[model samples]
Target: MVKFGYTILYVEDVEKSIEFYENAFGFARKFVSPENDYGELNTGGTTLSFASKNLGVQNLEDGFIESTLEDKPFAIELAFVTDDVGDLVQKATSLGAVLVAEPKKKPWGQVVSYVRDLDGFLIEICTPVEM
Candidate 1:
């Protein structure tokens, strides 16, 4: 059996990125490398991790596009399900997250919104979809 474990974002500053998630989402920090090139957060069952761009470059033979606030967000986004969509959006925005959309209720009865993290990574803040 296999399970999805962690998602690692390539960032300019690993430690700073870790701190941003901690402040915005209330996840506790797990570890940071002495070199400050990598870090992880205790985000429940699946870990959220960050690694420096330098590390990314070393890992991938071909180059990769780096995330920046000035550019449009990439195709993928990290989603966080919450009970209070409005409150979480406000909290994230308060910590410098750029609000992409206001919370809106879907036909399926879920409230959803979007925001971009400090490095321009898109994040979806939403209420869980009920089955």
Candidate 2:
């Protein structure tokens, strides 16, 4: 059986991506390069890494690749769970994240919202309602 441990994302600016994740999603940096070409972020139980395309070859299987004849940006969606969806939404919006959805109670007993990161990756912040 394969267990998922972490996810990696490719960005135009690793430093800016790191800062956005840290401020918007409350992730802390595990390590960062002086050149800002790459960095790792710790999200409680998992780690997310950011890399710049100009730095070197990226492992394509990580799922952040976008193919275009010209250099076009590509991004993926990542979900985060929180106890207070409203607060997280407010924090993310304040941090310059584009709000895609507002906090709303869902039928699955979850209050959720969606936001786009600096790199245009979608993120879902949610709180599971008690059944």
Pairing residues by index, what is the TM-score of model 1?
0.95
Q: Per-candidate TM vs. native?
A: 0.95, 0.79
**Per-candidate local distance difference test:** 0.94, 0.77
Candidate 1, 16-131: lDDT as tens digits: 89988999999999999999999999988999999999999999979899999899999999999999999999999998899999999999999999999989999999999999
lDDT (Cα, 0-100) at 9 in candidate 2: 72
The stretch of ten residues in a row with the least summed lDDT in candidate 1 is: 11-20
Tell me the spans in candidate 2 whose CA falls farther than 4 Å from its real position.
56-76, 129-131
lDDT of 2 at 120: 69
**Counted clashes in each candidate structure:** 0, 0
- Specify the highest-lDDT model's number: 1
Residue 115 of model 2, lDDT score:
77
